[model samples]
Target: MKKVYTISEVASLLGKSKETLRRWDKSGKLCALREPMSNYRYYKKEQLSFFEEFNNHQIQDSIDIKPQGDYNVLELFAGAGGLAIGLEQAGLKCAALNEIDHWAAETLRFNRPHWNVLEGDIREISFSGLRGKVDVVTGGFPCQAFSYAGKKLGLQDARGTLFYEFARAVQETSPAICIGENVRGLLNHDGGKTLKGMISILDEIGYRVIDPKVLKAIYYKVPQKRERLILVGVRKDIEIDFEYPQPTKATYTLKDALKKGELFNEDVPLSPGAKYPVSKKKILELVPPGGYWRDLPLDLQKEYMQKSFFLGGGKTGIARRISWDEPSLTLTCSPAQKQTERCHPEETRPFTVREYARIQTFPDNWKFAGPVSSQYKQIGNAVPVNLAKAIGESIVKFLNEKRLIEQSEKSLIAI
Candidate 1:
């Protein structure tokens, strides 16, 4: 029912950058109209139909297709349990989880005491014991390119990388489906050979790899503009097609995240947060909401950016302050880093630990384990819980369809 979308919304919807949209507007290709009130770029829904990528617009209401039976997932590289919790919310049980980080494993165990948290190197852990027990094998493996001599990469060739471990788990378990989650840059990492290698390895392991997709977190009800590349593979025997979840028209803003809104029942609880040094705080105060280093005074810009001021790129995240009306830029490992400063809209400080968790769509009760710095690292590195939930729903839908097909085939065999 939404007729118009802001430049940010359109960017997420079309999987294009705002800069690209501006370029299109300048060239008279998909021109944008200025909103009368704020003078911001906006596009009517009709204008988007011309693009091939705009074919799917199915909203969130219809995407929550329930599972036909109990489903279990064996999660690898389970950091802070973000994806695990989301899958749990979507009616999938965590049969087991493998996390190498001690703190993250502790967080997982602390949150869900019953969850089987295999704490140690994934290389040392064998998932062969879980063969045929788990319906899905999922992992957010860190992107690492395999060394190759122009030969097609295989499972053995990926030995040193975490992805190899993920594939090993999938092969050991022979799950009905497998998912690989990573940053969007993986598509272009090492000139796209890394991804091509990943597909080749998955195929060699007796799975059918589907084309990868970059799912913007904002489209899946997360209050951040983080984009994750999802790579799904079906076991060679599974006949059902795997479909990605459709984007929702509804979007949430920073205000919706921090304050009591539809996303949360109550205002964000105050907690310990990172602080900027006197020098950085002084410079950041000049930036307005939804602004970055570009908005600072001329002299201050040079002083703050120093050598980087002369750099070619936008450097938009420097001294950035999020606007209440807009979703936040992607969160980094540390909130107060010089390159990616996520300053509060009203206050000139990094978001509180709770606020950081909230922005990542973590529940209030989901207490993070470790020091403040470690906590930020865990929350920032996590997949937005809401986005994970949306993905979980899609997985459940796929498994449910597979279940029905198997049941029908069994019935025919009996007859």
Candidate 2:
């Protein structure tokens, strides 16, 4: 690769626009060089190291870290066993998983026959029996607005929402720690009141909520640039501090996800995938790898994008073709949607089921038990396996430290 890249080249590499690059240069986020003769701006290759894709390496050291003992986990809103499998890989045992979707529950049961898969509305379930037996409680609770009756938000104020059930589970199980994950938008949802309400409710339940942090999937071996906000709470009685997992310096790209390389031992297997309409396929064919609707000719752009052509934002996901060199954009439940098309790099079609699983870092052997569309939805909604495993390891470390402190205190009292 060249040591210096032009403005357009850097833009394409970063999946951003030239105008955005200019703004970054002005703001000192990513400075550019002015050529002596042509007065053209260029970026140094070393400067690109700040991005995850450029810094990716084959060695992944964190995968070797193991749990100290047989810690148990109770997962809520578990979808297709993504988080469950990851925790299992980190040496944490899954005591039970609660999910409402029938197909998702079937998928979980199909893969792990031994797991206690509870398929029903969480509001109907009682977690009191698991109290003191479970060490950790984790859930990917949907973000919903809580009715703020007053300045202070309580658990009762959140009734009827999924989060209320999650809080109730924590109160019932009285686990040492609880983790809640949601979309990155949750951090700013309802002008930030929603997240604040959630924190207050956890406090009311005797768990001290940690400052929420959004974790980037690409930084944890997932080949997609997806973000999830993580909310952690430690029981008030425990003095030990909880820590979030640190991001790995290495990253993976589309090639590593689909082709035989470091991320997988074999190439992606052929499987069923969604197809685009003939008209949509024709338009997408014009878009080169890593290009979107903006790359089309003026006449074609207007025809394909319609009113969106004159829209304010980039609308960059329209008819987009992913490149092998870069990480993929976040995957959606449906790949063929106009707003978020996930077309293949070489072929003019949407990614296959196996390809979708690979991008999420799922093992090839893990099968979905539903229709093709249902399979896509299950895979799309899952937490990336690698990202979940990283968090699981952190949970294990925290629990282990707490255990040691308890044992030492017991010995001191005996003396």
Candidate 3:
């Protein structure tokens, strides 16, 4: 008989939170069977043997989209096209995409000449032409709070906010579904008041907000420890519930990112990258794979870390060398920052542009324009391609069920 494991037991043994494991189950990234009598769940250990080294097993929900179908979508705040690329891969056709950054707008048009790329401040544009025509409307809108006028939040108060532009697009597009994504911090922003205001605005617009959830990138096959909060809204008239995508197993590592593995199949292609100062490089050279400032010689650690050495808490990200065996710390805007350091495992340098893209699960063929630093910034700020793909699949699943409901109603009317 295969060894059986309880959810809590597996979570403990892996050094991960139970909620992460439960989310994996909910997303269908891992398979578990319920106990016959108690209805408690158990995972058959044999199925997870492949991940014994890392104790990381995944259960991906069955939301897969291919190229044949046409899902007309309008994307707002489309930065560097990360989400757009993922959606396109999932059979969605880009009807139009809007971005404020000049370079990101240029990058989109450069990649797809025929695309209707709207490059300007969103406040200036009108979305009236798209009403009720698109299948899905999506964006990574910056989280902003709408001032409360009465007990309920009003759309007028949200006027100057970017989310208002997103909501306005939704109000105008009237798509069957809309997806909003943001950094994990958005969940607790303004002590969670920001999110509540968003929900109220969405509700006031006739869309029912689904229970939103945060997704950890490490669980979705990306080799980086990043997190994103996703907000899904279905038109109130639609009866179907939107299920978030399941995470896949990590077939990647910092080694896979900078070197080669199941993720890249070839070592990271050479590209321009940030360089460390001679002093910082010398200190980091003493650290080993997966080790941080603590791994350095006590005297050298103090010299390099300065006053930070006296600070409380783990200070784990400082002078840390990534490991072939573990996921990377989250990427920051600047790769070589003194405090939020992301060091390469074997080398004393920082991760390069290609390495950054690989960690974000971006394909090699996908190009990044502009100077080296801007390229890193774009990749760092992006939603991981694979993570977005899983999300795209989930959106397809949710919408398909909704389409079925419409069919049922029409059939009854005809009869």
Cα lDDT for residue 320, model 1? Answer: 87
**By TM-score: ranked, best first:** 1, 2, 3
- In candidate 2, stretches whose alpha carbon ends up further than 4 angstroms from where it belongs are 1-19, 22-29, 34-63
lDDT of 3 by residue, 40-148 (tens): 9887877566664234344433535553345688999988888888887676788999988877787788778888999999999998898867889999998876675
lDDT of 2 by residue, 293-362 (tens): 8889999999887898887887677788988877888999998977699889999999999999999999
Poorest lDDT segment (10 consecutive residues) of candidate 1: 52-61
Q: Candidate 2, clashing residue pairs?
A: none
What TM-score against the true fold does each predicted structure earn? 0.92, 0.92, 0.84
Q: Write candidate 1's Cα lDDT for 1-415 as tens digits.
A: 7788888777656755566677899999989999799887889989998764454443545546788899999999999988998999999999999988888888999999999999999999888999989999999999998986566778999999999999999999999999989999999999999999999999999999888999988777888888999999999889878988887756778999999989999999989999999988988899888778888889988888899999897767778888887788889889888768999999999999999999999999999999999899999899899989989999999999999999999999999
State candidate 2's TM-score.
Answer: 0.92
RMSD (Cα, Å) of model 1: 2.6
Give the CA lDDT, 0 to 100, for residue 124 in model 1. 94
Q: Evaluated with TM-score, which candidate comes out highest?
A: 1
Answer with 2 or 3, whichever has the higher lDDT.
2
